[model samples]
Target: MAVGARLTPDVLELDPAAATDRIVAELRTIVGKTLRRRGAVLGISGGIDSSVTCALCARAFGPERVLGVLAPETDSETETLRLSHVVVSTFGVPYVVENITPILAAARCYERRDETVRELVPAFTSGWKLKVVLPDVVGNDLYRVLFLVVESPDGRQERHRLTAEQSLAIVAATNFKQRTRKMIEYYHADRLNYAVAGTPNRLEYDQGFFVKNGDGAADVKPIAHLYKTQVYRLAEYLGVPEEIRVRPPTTDTYSLPQSQEEFFFSLPYQKLDLCLYAHNHGLRAEAVADAVELSVADVERVFRDIEQKRRTTRSLHMSSRLVEPVAEIDLSDA
Candidate 1:
């Protein structure tokens, strides 16, 4: 996928009020059609996406019928839980916290100490050169340090060596937390006879910055169509807590709560979106920079990142052979 394909500003320029109206209408239709006999279940992540989703759900189906699940892992921040509560209270919805820490801990302990590393080595070594392995490891560690320092002012350097096995184990453990939350979401949604509502925005979705089956699992997405800025607008409209709206967005996966911009790329969402828009319209990198009021080098860098992400997304979707084609079936004959 070229940067010029999906980053058009025209496509990104959506009318906020119309979009909200459309979202609310579509959500109501989805709930009416899918959960007419029961109700709707939404995994509330306490982020803008989920907050906006909860507000829309409350407006569409009423708070009583919309159940909010706070599926936090052991490492999830206290803020996540607090924000989840704020959303529930604001919407006056029934909420529950199903801590998956026990499940994750059990899963981690169930496997042998080196199991994950043993499994990952083959995949890692397949295309990796033996000579570059140590360097790659060092580079990753350095990047982690930089990330930590940026997110946490008090982060200290603690030299710790890791075997390849240990490194892989750490990676797997972090990934498990995300997958476990999704499992809980699925199970609870089924048990409660409600739809699983995914909380991903257009920016993340377009960037393909989500775990496919993990946080991406949802039956209905109330905020998927909105961009980050647009979500903020909706959040304000819905009276989301001031802290939540103002605080930087983070995944809170690591020890430090890293902002999405810091982890992804340093480019602000508005500028990134504008650059993307120019690029998607077949503008050259220099032209995009000029159009978006960014440096030429910055534009080039963002364009490259966008291109890379598009490729990764395409590879993931195509590899799974899960690209559902648009159907143009006609019922006139019937």
Candidate 2:
């Protein structure tokens, strides 16, 4: 930025071609030279982040060395499988489909989650669908809280405020899905001696949106520094499938369709990106209000929420504590 340059949405833009080359080069160094791994392995979710990651990995370590794993479970949307296939096929990468439903079922993931849901809505049963959502932070001044939504067999729906214990129980059970998928990813990586790639964008990475030791576990994350909006830019440059580029961001963890905004983030991704940028740059809420098309107060609310999430999720980024420091050897080529 130059002196007196305006701060608008343009500030977040970057040269997609340059970014692609830089990321591919860096991934080569990290995955090949530093990690000393044969290639890369990653789970493709058919989402923008994962799709872009697959494309970058293919460029970094040819399509033969890049393996895309499609791990779908019972609750996953029908399109998840199709879109995941589209991503791998577009990149011309060899992939294996790992159905994780049996693993989750063996762990009683659904059983525990349903038991918790039934505590709130007794009618929630085998034929019911369930999802958890947070209130609109920018549109409402109320405290941030989780609400449980369940649809009965005949299409009747109901929403209820979740008790603290119930929320923890539900989340704990659902976390099995992510951790289970990560286990499968590592299994293939270990067998092939490949590095595991993580696909969290700047928003999810910075805001602690991933499950620890689950989706958060990775050998290298190529897009952790790119915003969701910027990820879209790189997607186009990488020639990611058009269908994935146009698809809305989703959680895909719940039975019912759920947008990332309703599940966690306070605003739509584009607006949230601008607000996050302004917040990171120390720009006043009033300064970015018009750019993000939100009131100053709303921007302030979002800023507060950002900080709150950071404070709460700080532990998620930590390593195991030691009684004292221990020197470790470096094995990478100099």
Candidate 3:
């Protein structure tokens, strides 16, 4: 789609300094006017999106008023926690750490997902974590089959074709992580009278990268409109630790190594951002292909995948529908 001008390299450009100031003001207004909350609370996962969102929250609500909760599970990277602490301390945001492994354990998330994984790979054992990935399309035909990748602590790996039933059961079980984190965040929010801040940037939010009512549940999503690239720029402008600014984005959900690109999108985030922007602006596949340096066919494939996921996840993005109002009573003295 034409942006009504020649599409330059600056099409997706972000001015970090100015973006920071503008988002800070927007956050302040949301908390002060919309939510009427005294503060913001969030789960800081050490990713650029969360780091920038937390920094903005602290700037808007003061370090003392913002609570940064570190929710890590057994598979969580140690560096995730370390970087999380760096941001919390760097901003002096009041912090809490919750090890979420037990919660998942109690909810039978591990056993259930493992049970499903073992159906495909009987060698699945206690020392391993599993990640499920969908096969990519080539040429005019895309593969719709799913694959389960298992890795052991000593770094052994195996790939298995996963049945749809297994994938469904596995996802249903593992989604407890995000939902559990949301429950913890809200427990504090209830007591502190703060708004739970969601940290999804435009790409993740628009593409349904979040679990419904889990990581997707939040009182305020301050960065949902910014693209992944823009979030990094804000990280740099806000002095987010250089390590964090440079950290590769990961889903960080699986026990084994997995990146957001591998888990969901067909392309890396840098390229995907250009494709998403082009797609949103009504550009043809060829136009996006030129911008992100991909073949026209690849751009078309990404566009189709984007539409498929957006359609698939529409249910996750909706509110409950009711035929009649529950709270609005018709009879005054019934």
TM-score for all predictions? 0.73, 0.96, 0.93
Kindly indicate the candidate among 1 and 3 with the higher lDDT. 3
Per residue, candidate 1 scores C-alpha lDDT tens digits across 1-334 of 3544333344455566777678878887776764552556778777877888888887777788888988876557888898889889989989889988788778863243224433434332212211001221111323222211211133333223355556545545566766777887777677877777778887777777676677766677777657676787778877888877887777776544556776564566767767656656677776555545666666776777677678867643332443664468543442
Candidate 3 yields a Cα-based lDDT of 0.84
- The residue pairs found clashing in candidate 3 are 1-283, 1-284
The local distance difference test score of each candidate is 0.65, 0.92, 0.84
- Model 3 clash count equals 2
Ten consecutive residues with minimal summed lDDT in candidate 1?
130-139
Q: Candidates ranked by TM-score, best first? A: 2, 3, 1
1-334 per-residue lDDT for model 3 (tens digits): 3344434456778887788788888888777787788999999998898888889998888999999989999988888999999999888898999998998998999899888887877778887777878665435464576688988778878888777788788889989999999999999998999999999999889999999989999978888988787787778888899988888888788877778877777577888888888889888876666667878887888888889889989988897876987787543342
Model 2 misplacement above 4 A: 1-6, 328-334
Cα lDDT of model 1 overall?
Answer: 0.65
- Residue 262 of model 3, lDDT score: 70
lDDT of 1 at 81: 90
lDDT of 2 by residue, 102-196 (tens): 99999999999999898888777778998999999976777777999999889888999998899889999999999999999999999999999
